[model samples]
Target: MFKTAKKLFTSLKFNYFSLFIISLVAIGLFSFMYDSVKQETYELHEFKISPKTIRSLKTIEDTVKTEQEKRRIENEVTPFYQFDEEVSKTRQAIAASLFDFIIEEKKANIPDPENPDKLVKSRSEQIEEVRNKFKKLEKEEPGLRLTDEAIASLLTAEVSDLTKMKQEIVSIIGEELSKPVRSEDLSAVRYEVERKLRSSEAVPPAELQTMITLGRSLVVETETINKELTDKRIEEEKNAVEPTRILQGQVIVREGQFIDSEIYRQLELTGLLTNQSSYKPMIGLILYVLFVSAIIYLHFATWRTDNYQKKKSLLIAIAVFFILVIIMKLLSLIDKEFDVQVAFLFPTALAPLLVKLLLNERLAYMMTIVTAATAGIMLLEGFSAIMQMEIALYILFGGVISIYLLGNNGRRSNILRTSLVVSVSNILFVAFYLQMTQSTYDLSELSFYLIAAFASGILSGALTIGLMPFFESFFGILSDMRLIELSNPNHPLLKKVLTETPGTYHHSVMVANLADAACESVGANGLLARVGSYYHDIGKTVRPNFFIENQHGNLNPHDELPPEKSRDIIIAHATDGAELLTKHKMPREIIDIARQHHGTSFLKFFFVKAKELGQDVIEDDFRYPGPKPQTKEIAIISIADSVEAAVRTIKEPTPDKIAKLVNSIITSKLNDGQFDECELSMKELRKVERVICETLNGFYHSRIEYPE
Candidate 1:
């Protein structure tokens, strides 16, 4: 009655949605109690500049730009102004000019009151009034005074013409000034000197107007250039800083520094915060909420991960998930205190094991993604890049162990072996990764880590083993052990099949051996193949005498019946097997194997024999309703079926005769379209033939003793 109730409840009303909502709420409530006001915070708004600061920066940019344009203009028309280099040249030119001045005048014998080198040097620096500087005479210094006798003593008849010399110097200056500045050359000048010149200019309004005109043009062109540069700079700044804000600013988080609704309302009223541009912790809040939502999504999502149940298995997933994330979070907070590396080894090894236990090996592999995400975030947060490799190796180690241990069968010994392998695998992986990354790890610490990996494997295996019974009972999983138990001769159904249809039961055993041998030869699941063979004819137990094999030669019932009725009776076993397997909670794959064993092939000999005996015949009526043999095991069983029945028909068989019969039967099965769906290669078929021949010879051996 409890079984009926369980079945009824499972079949009628399993509310997955309600279960998901409840699971999430429970997880959330539990997590909320432990979660503090502060969690992991990502800074997005903190780097943001205020509007006033932005405007000040714009003003500064304009001033700098205007200064740059004036400088460019100064440099453009003249193409001859720089900082220290120009000053150095000015000093050298003044020295050279003084030598020229002395040579031209021949005033070496006479003691000049002033050194013309100092005068010319000072005058050359008069960038604002170069014309006026040379026209002035200094009276402030006593050094400028000269006696008439002394001035006359400086004169010489060998004097060069000062007028001609001055003319030559002026010509050189004109020649230098006549050269036009290239556009690119004018755009390169020191900004400070130009600013100083602009501030100190005294007269020459016309010259100032011309300079202003040039400055305006340069300002227009440079404004465009500066704007391009500013845009580019903004992009470069964005690229360098790499601004990213996630979660779409839509979700409301229950944790962290959230702006109170009351505070936001007041700020909105005062226009201190706008809806779009206001910094209200929205980005960070939404991102946290998204992270939380994704956690819930991964936990509650009804993903059909192979054998795992959605409604019941969610809680285990949620527990493991939070344990991983929370451990990561806690480790991040206290890493320095604990002296842990970027990530601890426990979680990486634990993730795949947990997935393998609660779900499938495929999902166990899928755990690598979550681990990678976890490692990626840690790397971004400041862990060594080497942590990623360690995490990857740990994930792969766990996956390999889980797949090797839990892929086909979950046994305690396999689990132990898996633990051993995981221990060794983790140690090897760590060794290689550390050597490559040049990490310093103590051997004692590594041994402890491997022990932890081994323990995790055992724990995951235990969990999987413990939970499997419930899932198999609940979701009707047909494990090989269950099938094997069901196929025992003592089973109620098998016993019924044996006593009620002894001939069919005997036939099924032979079929099981043949099918198992065929499957093993081709590297298929031999156990499933064997179990499927036993139950493939369970329907024969329903109506034993209807089948020829179970009739025990009691004046053939089909002899009096129409060919259609007889063929129906024969073809009915396949359909009957399907219904029984389904009703008894066998897996769909086994049901398919049973249903497709016969395929849509005609009952050739029986139909032809009936027709030759003068009965009206329809070819379609004699055919078995089928989906055909979809798997190698089923197709192999079909060929074995024909072989066993045909071999049984041979009244007196010898070893040599049996070999010929077995080869003939296999050839007929191949030619009769029985081998099409199996993907059976020629090599495998030959192997099957050899085994069947050997088995058949042993079963029918009667050798002469004189030969030996």
Candidate 2:
């Protein structure tokens, strides 16, 4: 079962990106199709029955023939189809009859003087008046060449012979019932008459009523026909198709159902589809994963070691980056009234954030690129071309600065501040992008986006915080937490070891100096060795007087005991040291140095004299635990232990004697295989032995007057 599950996970790993790509394409297709139908919702699908199928369908249904599918050529398609024709016909008929009504509608909707008929109507009046005056002029001048001035001159004198005119005229007009006006002044009189005709308030009378009736019929009939056609397709389908004739199926829509070139453009306005996203996601996923992995691969490649720790960190980083992307996915799944392209900003902006805290800046740079590409390809609505490019640029610019300025040396707020600054910078870039694409967007909207970015920044800070401890502990990574705790200057064991047994503490300090120098020169971690030395003999503090160095004013415990008893006391220190360190909860590395520093070295003087006395002394009882020093510090402490003690035994220790003594101690420790488990090579050990010799020689060189 386990094997099967492993194989399943491996398969999921191989083509997970394919699933993502397919899903994105499906969403694009569905959204475009749904939006197209919704926005142009006012239009209806028309179904015209073919002449052949109409009668057959009607005959089958036992009803009159009204409709069938595709019944005629589209020339027969109706007036919303024929809306232009209807408009033209209405324009013509209205001009002949309800001219005033048509003029009002024209004034309301269309641009300046759209109907040419109005101009034609007004011109007709002037044409009729000129012809009438010219005819009268022809009677007077006998030539068709009579000027309009002469025609106008003949006509106005004719109106004065009316009784109505005489009533308005002065009493002097009563002499001939009307006095004739001057013939040359007829132009002014004729203008006044024509002005009254054009501005007349009386409505058009009964003779033009048919034209009004026809115009009204055109509007009403067209509306009725359009409604019929608009509804015909669904109605006919409902009536004609029997349930048994149809296929049983789910509501599956196909690809080209949405991508019709005829209406793709108009469909996009409703927020459905894009021309771009069909295969972009697959491309993006490949690039994103590769880009992120490349960062991990480079850092580890810098070191020659192909160790699991480096590979494990790489795995963790990629997992974290991908997990953040998934979180963004879930966030986008939330319903909002608008497209939050900047929700994408959270993930893009947060990538560097996670990388900076969890990994390094070089990795952060690569991950930022991944973030930008993924967001641009996935989260965005696929309209603006430069969103990915701009976001990427901003992330690099701001994120690199954040890593540089935020050294690995401050409080967590350094990361927080870096996130805040990166988010702000990214928001600014987003705002500029919004302006470039949609030039008329409100500036206040940018304020809201910036605010959102700040919120994301806070979230990024929080996420980095939340994940830090988990990453450190799960990976067993030695990070700032470990460093900070170690640097506390008040670790309990350190304090107790210092206060109770300052002599052993001072010895441990000198050993740390010797070990640190040798460790560093050979390319090992020196600080680790130094810190280890400070606490290596902390067990000696528990029984301070039992050890030689801490027995300042006390008598030697071993002086009165037999040589065998002295050997037992001497061998007991390693075990007692282990016990004391274990009780104090010191690290195992220190405990190992305490217990194994003596290795199986016997009580040399006691074992020799016991043999002379013909007494039986078990050698194993005198030996320390067998697994000796596993590192240079451990082995160095082992040798330093005997060297420090043996040097003190010689009262007049000269430089030559100190060197001889240190060399002999190191050489004896080496020949005994006491340094076998340690990583210290012979060459390095030889150097350590020399350093110990030199350091002790300097201490004893000027103090030669002292004697045992």
Candidate 3:
């Protein structure tokens, strides 16, 4: 059943379709993460009761509130006004000209002190002439206007009163003109001038009114609103107001609470209003999924990785990816619903552990990064960026630790030890992350996260243990764990060989040691070679007396039969062992080793015996079935098997003898084309010869001489 499934998955059409299906399912699952914040729409109104809570789907600037704040700041800014020195100078000059004209007219009315011949005019006539001249000046300078009564007073008053009026009017105009005088404050300026004139008592009562009227006329509007400066100030203040932001996951409206205008606007701003739908998130999610898919596809398609070339490997990779992604998605949902940090309880190391055990470590490391990235993206909406980073790093580091701790041994104890180490590492990672990111720690939350971390490790180990067998069976994989199980002495096949053919069992054990060491030197699957060696001689148990190893001192069964019968019995063992293994549902690799270890080598003893007896015989008939060793492990086992059997025939074994024998056997196998189907390079073959010689020398080493 498993073989059929493996064959089905291996089909090129099925591989493409399976990848498509996996990608589709992954995108579908991830769509929920992208659309997680699509809350139910509301028909809420201002000052009405809200039926349900509404949260922001994404972070966005609250433009309405921000604009309101900007406007308020702008209104509060004082309008800018600039002082006009030109206006002050002009006003003062006009007032001085008016006063100087009055003084000139007064001087002309009297005779000059130095010139007695100058014409002296009457006071009435002088006042008439000054009024006529001032009237003309007023027409020329609008700001210099004065009433007829003020002008008559200026001319008719005493010289002291005239002097006081001119000085007071010019001083008042200068003082008032120096400061900003807007059109709107012209009345205030006139009243101020009257008060100053009244308080000073500088001018006589008759001329005081004249001074007041003249002071008001001198103080024309000196300051105007500087429109550019006023606008610039408003803009500067408006820009200083920070923008209001509605953060993602912020609650816009709470259930059973009043929905005010602000809340209604927030709901609309965040797209929580009725009939609002945004496809941007969905589009972004599709792009992200495609990117991840493309990365995986590129690794498998372009890289020269050994396992990547196989379709079953692709299936296993996709399977592990789906498992981790789905598990993380479920954990994210649980964390959301429970409001607890259940994300820390995710089986972060499970994907890497399973992949490392079933396939290569490089692919395991790749899956670790992919899994962590997927988890981060899935939880980004629900968690803060710091927390998201923590989760991703936790998965990444935990996976690396698990891969290293798993080693190459897949024993139960080793897995348990790895889980315990992972648990401790997880606790330390959580504590460190929290300490670094959080300003203050909550004891309960920290303890919960730590506990979740420990539980995640334990859970990952438990799940890996439980699922390993299922995956191994489903994929027809011969994992290290399975090889260890098959290598046990108590196994039915090994026990059968031990009880039925003790000598063959002993010989098989020696061959197992030799093959295991040789394959390891050449970087092959040493455990597989050892386990295959254990069951290689199971067929010898069927006719235990016929084979020489199992014959012990019993009469040789081959001596009683014809050489043809003996040759048939010897060649039948290879096929018989293959049949037995196949019937027991053994792994294909072990069965292949059992079937092809001999590589059609000529049984020279049997063939030579037939030739000496003058019996008809063909060279092909003397050889075992010709399906030679097809892998490095099988090829090494074949050489080791022949070397070990040949070495046992040496009466006086030595390291030199064993070395020479190991080299000779490997060279003969090479010349006979037995290693042609296997990928054993010449360098690797040399290493194998040295390792086999060392192992055999150890086994056959002479013991220290002792007194009896």
Candidate 4:
């Protein structure tokens, strides 16, 4: 029944149709991921504010509030300050110049008492001349003069007191103007100078008042605001505000709560508010599925395997992919309905494990990529985009690690060990991801992730162990596990051969060794060839005395029988072994090896006997029935079987004799057209010959004769 099913699956037409159906199912499922049902719409008046506060359902940026808060923080920032050294120095210089002009004018206006002819100007005229000079200086340089009160006070001062006041006022003004002064603080600075001067008794009361007035006018504003610095400070503060995060399953709008503009926008961002424009998401999803399906098709089309095996592999890949997708979707639904983190416990490595065991490792890695991508899309609900991406990467890394640990061929114990490696990889990936995202390291949450990682590995191993036999039996696949099981010495057929015909059993073991080496040399399934060679002679168990290998003490049961009967007995083992293997439900490849190893070659020994006896016998009457070897492994086994039997006939085999015998046997088999059905190349055949010759020569090498 499985044979018929396998044949149907491997057929060209069925492969194409199945691929199409799988692609369609994938497209439908991916599209359903984003197909949102129309949400219930309510009018503004229908909304009522609830007494209890409501929270956001999804993590969405509140653009309106975020921008508003940023702007408010920016407005509250104080402007920057810039020191104006040039302005301060200019003000000090102008004050010093005004003092110098006053002192010089006081000296110049002194009456010339020594000379009666010299006309002396009146004090008022001199004061008027000094005031005109000050006015001219003010017109030359703006912001250089004192106030009206300060000028009036300086003009009425005594000459000696005025000169002393000029030095004191200029020194005080320079000291005050040296510091940064804002426009708003100018009056306060002036008052501070007046108070300082009033407390000083070094100058007369009139001079002190004049010094205070001049100091007030000299204290001009020098500091200005720096807009660039203020703006930079505001930007840094705005960036420091934590982005609002709405936990998964949080309530966006509670029952009977008013749907404000903010709530409405949240609903829209979360995909809860649907409109006619929603079909765009579905269209995008379909395109994505189509692209992935194309990749799958290209991988299968380019795979370097037989057409039948390619179809079988494709079917298995599609089945595994859909199984993973279904599991992911179910887990997502559970997470959504129960608000649990079951999705984290998903065994993403399960698909890769199955592929690695039942198929090739390359296919396993490829399927892992496809499964991870599909899972990321399917489990996007209730997860932030970043979380979904992390989950996908986590799945990819886990699958890769599992495949790497499984290696070329895995055993049951290897599966357990691989699980441990996968678990460690998963834990490391999760830890790295959390650390990179800067999430709070809650011990409970971390423990949960650790548990999930361990569970993923254990579950992957369990699922692979449980599903491997079914795939092997259903698909007629001879996986390495199955071959290993068959290669055990305690297998029923192998044990039967061991007990009933020890010599033939020994011969089969030798053939297995030879076939294994030869097949390995040519890059064939060496394990399968070894296992197949073990049971290739099981039919000899039925009549151990009829074959030469089981003939002990020179006893030959075929001597009493006719030549034709002896030939019948010899050839019957091939067909009889095939029947027994089939009855025991052995793999077809092993049965074919037992059936076709001889490949209808003429039994020349018996035929020569009949011809020497003057009896007319046809060549066809003494040939073994055969369908010929059908694969590289089977072909190698067939050649190795004949080579082992031929080498055993040499009583004292030498290296040159063994080489000649091996070469002659291979040449005869080639001329007999035994390997026409298989894909064994001429180059591979030469390598097989060399390896078999080397192994046999070493096995049957001359030993040192011991003195008895």
Candidate 5:
């Protein structure tokens, strides 16, 4: 069952599908966190303004207050009035015409004492004539009629009094009509005209009463309300009242204070009332996750590694990413429940340190960004958006520092040193941000942040140190530290090989030097190549004398055995070394080097010997079992191994001889199709050849003999 599961997991389809599932899980976790913080809230009861002041949590305009203010301003606005000059002129003309007609009638009807021939009428006839003329004039002009008594009183007056009264009444009517007269002010204006007429003794009471009646009719409302102007004034007042704005982070209600209507409204506006449900948060989380996933995918697509290593690297990165996210979420929950300032205490740099140590640095940096973003999302609930961003940047700065300081993971103490550096950097960053924001200089608050920064760094180091081994072991990752540990001469496997096959050990060391130099020149992993070379010949320990390197005084062990037996013994070293390395739990990369360094090359000497002895020896039967080198380091090790063995046989090694020997060995390997599976380009192969030739030339340079 375990083997079947292993096979399924190792398959390409299964690995990709598993990656997809992991991505889905990551997005799902983020969405879950978003929902936890931004879920729907509902107010159970209504509230009103009574005994407490109501403040707003979020900035919003008070539409209710604005509307009420508009109404009040509208009520205070005075109605607009306009005077009609045409109405006043028409009324004056009618009054003057009435007086003129009365005077003319009086003149025509009065008895003439100087001329008896003239038709002189009595006072009654004159009054009747004036009444008849008034009736006619009333028909022509509607508001000009008067009573017979008023006409008689006007006729009995002296000519000068009559003229003065006519002028006075006409002037009074014109004066009253010129002023603004609303419908309600008509009677008052008529009374004012009667008062003026009564003050004058030149006019009789009946005439004054008649003049007052005429003034009432003449004082029609000349001014009307201008609705456009009145409404404009009210609108201007409404606009003048500024909208009330509530700032972000402003306190909505104090503790133990009654909730008011405006406070409740603000709570609703800020989504604190919890009555609204929305899918935006969930959608945003999904989009954010997808963006991160796309970046991861792009990194993988662009990475230059073998399929197996690429799969492993991706899996490790995903695992680290989720682990950091979980830690952030946990810290967020604690911060929310305890109301403590512990959110910054999260060890955000832990994942980046682990990734950098156990995986590649570029992948580590990518995971650092992802982890910081996740931390920001987690801290968004209790802090303002600006604060959340600052927290995220804080995490990013610390993570970057950890990655940079921990680049060389040769010793375990580097982790602690990196933590210290990260802590200092975090503290400095916090100090800078605080100073820029001009926050209160409360020592307690500053100390809390400083402590959190220190704790975050130290905790990150501790966690990374503790968890790195597990990740390396579980993922079968061969980190630099693990490689250094394996390279230690005190290791049991290396000690055994040193004791059992001392000559082979010396040969391995020489080969390691050559391979390390060649690999370093081409930008491959020099340490890995050197370490793999150290254990490549461990299988030679089982039969030390059978190998030419370990044989002393040319014992001719191969001469005593048949060609087939010799080939089997020789080929067994590759498999034997692989098995031993695997048993010792060495990295797969080093084990692969042990298994593939020989690369199925034929044992030509033994094959020639067997053919001369009349034995039908198949060439394939004399080859070492090999999967070939699978990386540039392993491939360089294969070439270096052959070059070192060949160069050791040279009696008088010269620079020209060493270069020829190195080129021959590389040519043989190329002809044997040893580098087919790896991603080494032709240009890189040429570079490797040149580097190996140069290194071998230096190793076997001609030396001047000292005269002894």
Candidate 6:
């Protein structure tokens, strides 16, 4: 069953399809989780009693109320009226024409018929003549029409009073005509003219009364309703009216309260009514999940490594991602349901910390970004866009902090310490966000956010401590912490090597130091190399006297055996060590290093000895069975293992001789194609050569002569 599952997961298709399935699950998770349509359905009838309160799951504009407000403001705006300057001038001209006719009649004084020099007409006779002439003139000019009473009063008034009255009447007519006098306001404008005439005192009371009547007639409605300007002004006011928004989580109706038209409309608008589900949000969520999945796939593609290609490693990352996302979703749901900001309490750093511990740092950074984005999306229903962005950035910063703090230190104490520092970072981030986004900080809000921030970090540490063992066990992951524990001297495997083969144990320790330093020089897993080197010779414990490392000064067991037998014994140790590590449930990487360190290099000494004995010998018979070193660390340990064993044979070691020996062994490994399967570059190989030589010189340097 395990083999079949492994074969199925190893396929490239499985990787792509796994990502597709994850995207689908994510879309479904966001679609149905806390959606308003999934809530209890409410009745749509108006004026009915509500059984329960309903809140909006998403923000939406209340279009009905917005339109009603627009209409109301449109109605409240007064219509625009335009004044007619031409009408004012024409009315004033008519009043002027009447006064001009009276003046012209006065100017046309006729000579007396009885006496040439003296006027023969009586004052009454002259007045009657003037009135008759004015009547004739009034027929010629239609605008000169006035009451006979006003005409007679004007003629009887003093000339100065007449001039003043004419000037006042013309001035009042022009002023009133210039104003915006709509037909509805014409009566008011006429009353205003009469008040002006009475106040003016331009003539006697009787003449003023007569002038008031004439002034009212002279005033005409000179203003008209401007439909274009009126409509434009109303439109401007309507645009200024802000649309009423139905915010998410706002109550639509209270329990046992009447559901009026507005409340019912709001419920329908928010999709709380039965059978009113909208698939728009679901579509958006699907697209979002696809986008995130594509980015994750590209990240993996760019840095494709054998570790990431393993199904278990990929599964561990996926598990961490889903765990963090689920926690975020649950917290967001609580925040929405209780109207609190509990979502801010989510352990945002959990994903990055776990991934960093189990995987590489680059993958940890990817986990940080993806989890932060998912948190932002999950809280979209509960927070504003700016607030969501701030939370996302905060989560991002926290994840980065966690990853950095746990750098190659996956021990429990280090994890907790890193988490404490992450908590401090979280607190600082929240404080900064509050200071930037808020005008007057609410003490309650600040306190809640701070508590959530601090707790989130501690919870991340706790949950990581709880879940790490499961991941390590289920996935057979070789974390740094596990490697450290396995490297302890008290471990059963290491103890077995020490008691049964003390010489081999000492040799293994020396090889470990050499491999660890060389591995680190080339940016490989040095701890894995060191720990793997310790157990690499565990197979020698099976027949302690057979191998020279465990032989000490004792007779070699291979002396009694044939050359082929000796070669087989030497070759069997690689397979034997692999079996022991497998039995002890050691990591695959350590087991591979032990099994492939010797590679297929021929045992030259045994083969030459067999040939010298006049026996038929094949080259293949003297070779160690190997799959070759398949990683940089395994290859480095292979070179280091041979270099350490060979360097011990030197009687008078110096830096120059150690350098020559290291280079020859590396070149021989290269010629034998032992490192062909790994990705160790020539530049890195040279670096490894230099590091090993330096380390050997330190170990085997000439000591100062001491007086005895």
Candidate 3, clashing residue pairs? none
For residues 108-148, what per-residue lDDT tens digits would candidate 6 score against the true structure? 54446676565545445555665675675456545445666
- Candidate 3, residue 175: lDDT: 82
Please provide, for model 5 over 485-511, each residue's C-alpha lDDT reduced to its tens digit, 9 standing for 90 to 100.
Answer: 889999899899899999999999988
The TM-score obtained by model 1 is 0.53
Give the least accurate 10-residue stretch of model 4, judged by summed lDDT.
Answer: 37-46
Collision pairs in model 5? 41-274, 41-275, 42-274, 42-275, 59-246
For each predicted model, how many residue pairs clash, with residues at least 3 apart or on different chains?
2, 6, 0, 0, 5, 0
Q: Give the range of the ten consecutive residues with the poorest summed lDDT in model 5.
A: 49-58
Cα TM-score per model: 0.53, 0.44, 0.83, 0.67, 0.77, 0.81
**Model 6: clashing residue pairs?**
none
lDDT of each: 0.54, 0.52, 0.80, 0.77, 0.78, 0.80
Model 1 has how many clashing residue pairs? 2
Minimal lDDT window, size 10, model 3: 378-387
In model 4, what lDDT does residue 198 have? Answer: 80
Q: Write the per-residue lDDT of candidate 1 for residues 29-140, one digit (tens) a residue.
A: 3343222212222222322332231100001122333444544443443222222223233323442343244443443334435863333332222222322321232122
Deviation in angstroms for 575 in model 5? 1.1
lDDT of 4 by residue, 268-351 (tens): 555554351345455767777777777877787777667766777777877777778778877877776643356667786898
| lDDT string, candidate 2, 594-703, tens digits | 77776777566777777778988776655655567766767776676678778888878888888888888888887888877667888987787787777777666773
Predictions: Cα RMSD each: 14.7, 21.8, 4.8, 7.7, 5.9, 5.6
